[model samples]
Target: MAIISWREQMSLNYPPLDSEHQAFMKVINQASEDIKKRHIEGMEKMFQACYDYVRNHFSHEEDIMERIHYPEMEEHIASHQLFIKNISQFRQEFETADTVGKKLDASQKAMAFLSVWFLGHLISRDKPMKPYLVRLRNLPPRMNY
Candidate 1:
């Protein structure tokens, strides 16, 4: 049970970006599902995968933005940096806190942070960048819809 699930509406009309975002949601959902199932041993692995995948996604998007000469590139990068810091803090907290198996779940803060971050970044930053990406990439990017 995660707070959010990936939906077609979230697509940025860019195949690579859409696929990356879907992968992110899948990883997050899998971690949440594991926690709910009380799969104690694999929690660390799942969390690490989530974090690593996100870093990869961020890099991918940033590289595309750079090629576009996106005017808001620095601001978007700063926003991403803030997100990474929060996620890193959540990982640290999850590592040190000694909670029982059943009690372990994604913290509300982490869920909220992710929901807002995804929505805000996609809607505010991502949507606007699509045309530039399209023109720069000069290809029809895949999308969920």
Candidate 2:
């Protein structure tokens, strides 16, 4: 079973971002299930997919923020940076554990970290961007995401 499930309340009413968030939720849920089943290979694959997706997603989001000149851009970017750093650290731990024959434990820890961080970030940081996104929605289609 998956650890985290997506809720409609999590939506920020921005299609592109919402779609990305939904995709993230799917990956995290699958990863959580893989961890619970002790499927080391599956977990590793999911982790790599998530890591790549997050990097791209964050870059796209930051670009949007920059284009919009969001007032809280610095804070938001910092948060994104922290997330990337944390994921990198978790990846390192996972790799080290695998080298030491502790893959299961490290995978579980990584999944747990991702579950908590994903939900918290979506609610606290992403939700607040709704207003800004809504305003952006008013612009021409090309300008909007």
Q: Which candidate is the best by TM-score?
A: 2
lDDT of each: 0.70, 0.79
The per-prediction tally of clashing pairs is 2, 0
lDDT of 1: 0.70
TM-scores of the models, in the order given: 0.77, 0.88
How high is the lDDT of residue 71 in model 2? 84
What's the CA error at residue 114 for candidate 2, in Å? 0.8
Query: Per-residue alpha-carbon lDDT of model 2 for 1-145, expressed as tens digits?
Result: 6567778899888888999988888888888777767788887887788777777888888877876778888888888888888878878878877353477777777777888888888888778777787667556656435
Over 4 Å off, model 1 = 1-3, 101-108, 138-145
In candidate 2, stretches whose alpha carbon ends up further than 4 angstroms from where it belongs are 98-101, 138-145
lDDT of 1 by residue, 40-64 (tens): 5556665677578667887888877
Tell me the lDDT of model 2 at 96: 76
Tell me the lDDT of model 2 at 44.
Answer: 81
